[model samples]
Target: MTPSATPEPSPAPVLVLMATLNGGPALQEQLDSLSSQQHTHWRLHVSDDGSTDGTLDTVAAFAKAQAAHGRDVAITSGPGRGFVANFLGLLAGVRDDPAFVALCDQDDVWLPDRLQRGVEALSKGPADQPGLYCSRSWVVDQDLQNPRISAAFPRPATFGNALVQNIAPGNTILLNAAAAQLARAAVSAAQAVPGLPAHDWWLYQLVTGAGGLVIWDPEPTLRYRQHRSNQIGANKGFGATTRRFSAMLAGRSRSWTDANLAALRGAAHLLSPESATLLEAFDRARRGTLWVRLTAPSKLGIYRNGTLAQAALLLSLALRRL
Candidate 1:
């Protein structure tokens, strides 16, 4: 008689954190995509920021359906501050849990292998060391059609690069146990700071600053839907470039940089000594004279993604706008 085949081991659990604020229009599609993930070992925790719409109803129905499959979904009332605060609060709530954490946007459609790819990439690294995996996305219109790949950043992901630019899109970020722990430890400090620019940018800085491993996969993992109501849309093409430059010229970059630096300083103890020193140097460079500002990028070894962006950064420094 033939012996029964061995059962496959269950995959590691991942805690997916999603922050929502009136995301009803496309929430169902996003939930369906999450249910379709190839790696089924995931639990979802959504923090709603006072949604007056049917977002909670959609989540409840999804939760009821998923419960039958042995998957769990939890909902919580957010801080009601904003998306940044809502995400930070979610991170704080899961600070003690050892499962891998993934940030999800309310409107995007994740591919089936999204969790599998991120989990596999992060699994190869040392368990004690922080590991963050982020991937490119296929930019799609509101209806998920007219797909085009997001711009690729070939530069190395480091603390220095994260100080000036954010390449890791939040929707695609996956943090291993160690990295999630680090983020949880620092969430309180981050929440104390007002107007923290973006949680994804802060995670990019925090992971790299703690000397963590960052894997930037070039393959597209999800459909990044661009619509009129998106909090942050796709940043590609000449029109977007022009808008970015214009924003910088209008001193928006400086404001964002200020907020980021303040938030980072509040969590300075969580960063490595080397990263702390680099952060201080960059902070000082921003406060220096015109000549110092002009030479700061090369001296501090901070950079953006492409040559055009790098040039624009230099110009912003020269104009005292960054």
Candidate 2:
């Protein structure tokens, strides 16, 4: 008799970290989407920030249903400070786990292949080196209609670009084991600093600063739903452009820069030597005179995405607003 074939082993599980606050009915669709991922070996941990809109009940129901399917779903009380803290706290709790980590949004509808694609892409990199996988998303209206793709970055993802702008959206980010460990180690310092930018932005900076690999997949991986309750909306279209430019002029971008620099400084020991030097240069450039500001971008290789964005960055430096 012929010998029986060996069974294929299942893929390594992914830890899906979601932060929620008053998610209401929208959270249900997001939960359903998570249940339908092509990569079935995922465990979800939701951090709810004192939701009074039945969000906890919704999570409980989803958790009970998923449990029956042999999937592990857990919930924890969030820090109640805000979404940023809640996410960082969730990431901090990921101590020593070997699974890849995916940051999820409470309102976005993920495509079925989201986890599968991320896992496949991250698996190609060296196991010891940190790898961050991020992709474009189809920005849809509240009902998931009127789809529009997010912007594409023409240049490479580097620490320089990350210092001033974030190309990696949080909802679509997946970190391999190495990157997850790095992030887990850095969260305490990040959490200690107040007013830090979004968790995704900090991750981009932290990974690139540490000389890790950043994989930018051109494919759209999820439906980024835009609604009145979105903390951060899609970064596309003239309206979005105008809003960003206005924010830069209003010194809001400057505040974010300050916060990011402070947090990066708190974790300076983890940065690569070259990245450390660049960070110092960028910090000086932000505070130097007009000529230094004008020359900083070319010298430090600091950049944003497109021509228009580069122009805005220059203008912000000139105006001392960024």
Candidate 3:
């Protein structure tokens, strides 16, 4: 993604795609972060999920201003689709020859090296393993007072694990064209499976399930924000987010239930045959047909890998807290 490597007319520009809703509060901070990215050879495409607020107008103005300033920023209407659909639609809309596609959120602030580092990682794998390269993030808030993070990235990830639980946040995802093609195809094929999770997390599973690769870079290259209006669960500190999750479990927050469960089931189905031991344990634990409940500790941790122990720990905590 060097500044001088121009798109040779035959292809579409390397694009940065963002799916935004009522994100007006921190839109400019996101825009500025992109503007300051270390790589300058990319174009920006936005799919607005019908923002009732000034979100759409703000992005329009920002693009226009950037255009006036000679930067490559573009905006488009998203037909009022929700977050997941708009994300899929935006990437699918990229009919142009895309070398790579990066996901951006309107609220998070990215470090300057995200795109550049991701490009390097993808380059190492080549078209053979074109899944996605993602890094961990420093989960923060608007004020950036408290940052909660773990050494989660640069860890082993595959389709099986990904289907069960998302490893990297969406904002840290960067995929090459071949991987993007595979992702689009998987989404189209998953029509039968309607209740999937976030498009970013789902795409990671899809690409890997198709025999692609996922590489983690371990660096916290993005600032993930948490707020009361979060669509899913927010990324508070280990203690804080966990305590809040226990509360949500008590309340049985609908959004969190739908998103997380769908993620678990989907990830479970992606396990390879070689992963049958872990896979069987995960599926049985997740499957509700049985009288028993799942409580596996994921190989990764208490929350990830969709293991029986992790699930059990979560339920145990919830039961105690509730």
Candidate 4:
């Protein structure tokens, strides 16, 4: 008889970090979705903000259930700061395991293939180089019915566009060990800088700026929940797009840009020379006249996804709202 073939070992576990605040209602569904993932080699780390609801109890129960399946799950107190900071804390809490890390929202259903697809795509890059994987998401209502696929952005994820707009959605992100380590270091360095932007946006900038690869998959792998209290949801229809444009006109977008720029500048040591030059040009354009703003961005090769959105950017510059 032939000798028994050696069994293939399981791959490194993907670390899924989720931060919660009063997540009782939908937390169970999200956790169940994770349990159903096709990628079995994974662990969950949840950071909970102080909750009056039964969120912690729900997480505890789910953790106990998952433990029987040989999956590791941990629940801990979140950083007292808001959601963005809470996420940063979770990212920093990851150990030096040379594993991929995924960001999870408190209330979303991951498809069975989400983790598997992310890991497969990220594995294509050199392990020594930083890699980021993000995908579009299916926008769903509260009950997870009538799902509409999110529109694909035509604009590429260049450093110039990354400086101003964050096309990366946090829940859809997967970062390899190298990228996660770089992000942790950037987060630490930017702590002194007040008003840092969202963790996903910052990571997009940091990775692209450092000459790392950011793969944007057109295929979605999760259901993005849209509800009353969504911090950020799928940018889908005309209404959503218009609201974003209005925000730019209202200076809200500019404020976010300013904060992001400050954080980028604070972490300048990590940026590649080309990215540094792009950042400088963006800064100068922001302070220049309408003609200079238009001319400078063109030279820098920055653009938003849609033609209309790109036109709006130019209009914002001309109006001095950018």
Candidate 5:
């Protein structure tokens, strides 16, 4: 008798954490794109932050359809804090599940190979070590037309760069199992602070500060939708960039830095020795005199994205702004 062929072992499952808030306009398209991912072994866990629109219903219907097709899907109410808290809650919900995690936005259209590329990139690294994978994205209008590639950062990503600028966009991020665990451990620390500038930035800080490996993919993987009602739009043009610089001068960036430092200090036990030292020096420089602030960033290796950005940082220091 002919022997029956043995079934192939299934790929490791991935958990996608999507946070939604009034996403009715283009939520279905994003869901459809996710359903089309080449990496099929992914479960989508969506958390809605009290949407007054039909966002939750749309997600619920999508989950039902996916479940009927034998795919794992779930929906839940968010913490009502904000997007950052909503994402943190979802991360906490899957703490011990031992699955790869990807952060998803309700308004972005992921490419067919988004999950596949992330898995392939992460699989090359040491599985036992914490690792984060992030990539560039294509900025598009609401209709997903007129695509423009986001600006590339010439310098390598480091905790130094992460201190002031977040090069990694949340929509294009994927974390290995180890990295996700580290992030979960910091959720309480995040809640201890009054506010977080951005969840992705906090993850970048936590992962890098804990001596984890961070990979930056040069290729674009998703459509970052720009709309009038977006909480944070595709910050691409000169006007947006100038406004960001102005915020630094207006002490908003300094306030964000203070908040991040407080959160990190609360979780000091989790950081690597080197990272702890660096964080301390950064805080000291923030409160130092004009000359100290001017020279301390360079001495401490704290830098921004580009040369112009670095110059602006120095200017902010001289003016006692950052």
Candidate 6:
């Protein structure tokens, strides 16, 4: 008699994670956008950091209202877990029960196919070497219209293209189960290291470090709404000389030279030598005159040509500080 073949493992549903704050006005817009996705296998896991403005209660009420209709929705909260920690906290929520995790911001509105397109890309890759993928997004005003994003960066983002600048936002990201499992470790590494920015950057590094792909989807899946309350809004000025001067005077900065150097050095262990070399250049960039730093022995010419990741990062860092 012929022996029965072993069955392949089944795929888990996608989990959408959103970290909320005083997101009273825009929270529903985002949630409504998510609920609009044709892909219904996904679940929304929102972590309300801390909001005196009824943010948690609003989310709770909405989830309950949605659940009465049999929607797979839930609201969870932790102490003021900080923005970065709130994103990481979801990993703990799903660590024992892993799923394809998508990072959702409290404000942005996703298009109908956001999660569907991401899942198609991720589901095709080898599960053992899972990854995170982000799509390009339209930078819009608080009204989510006019072309703020196009005016700000006005360039397509590729893994290599973003080497000097990161145009991807958390709301547009989709991290696989493997990456979710590695989130805590990645955070710990960042804490132990120095210059790493936040959960998003660390997740990118850790997943890509293990030979996993950090795919870039060029489609604009999000209406990236810009407002004052955002932690890191879409930066319009290109290292604007006036803004730079103002930034310097205002003492707004993301990293000192030493801390950035350490973070880059730490990432070396998480990426290929070629990628590591690039990260080193970015790390040294915070030191000033990256051209000069690139000439140093320890510094590698990561942005040899038209690498844009550094500029994107600078914009985000500057925007965050501002």
lDDT of 4 by residue, 222-266 (tens): 999889889876776888888888888888877888888888887
Error of 2 at 59 (Å): 0.6
Tens digit of lDDT per residue, candidate 2, span 254-314?
9999989888888899999999999999989989999999999999999999999999999
**lDDT (CA) per prediction:** 0.92, 0.93, 0.65, 0.86, 0.86, 0.63
The model with the greater TM-score, 2 or 6, is: 2
Q: Which stretches of candidate 1 lie over 4 Å from their true place?
A: 1-7
TM-score of each: 0.96, 0.98, 0.74, 0.96, 0.95, 0.74
The numbered model that scores best in TM-score is 2
Ranking by lDDT: 2, 1, 4, 5, 3, 6
- Candidate 6 matches the true fold with a TM-score of 0.74
lDDT of 5 by residue, 170-233 (tens): 8988999999988888778887788777888888888888888888898999999988877776
Off-target runs (Cα >4 Å) in candidate 6 are 1-12, 69-72, 79-81, 147-164, 191-196, 236-292, 296-301, 304-322
For model 4, the run of ten residues with the poorest summed lDDT: 188-197
Of candidate 1, the 10-residue stretch with the lowest lDDT total is 91-100
Report the CA-based lDDT of candidate 6 relative to the real structure.
0.63
The clash tally of candidate 1 reads 0
- C-alpha lDDT (0 to 100) for residue 17 of candidate 1: 97
Per-residue lDDT for 3-98 in model 3, tens only?
A: 787666533246898988889668888888888888767788988877889888788778887786566777777846467777777776777757
Error of 4 at 9 (Å): 3.4
Model 2 whole-model lDDT (C-alpha atoms): 0.93
**Please, what are the lDDT tens digits per residue for candidate 1 over residues 1-322?**
9999999887999999999999977899999999999999999999999999999999999999999999999999999998999999999999456559999999999999999999999999999999999999999999999999998999999998999989999999999999999998888888888778899999999999999999999999999999989878787998789878888888888998988888888889989999999999998898899989988999989999998989988898888888
Q: Which ten residues in a row have the lowest lDDT in candidate 5?
A: 90-99
Clashes by residue pair, model 1: none
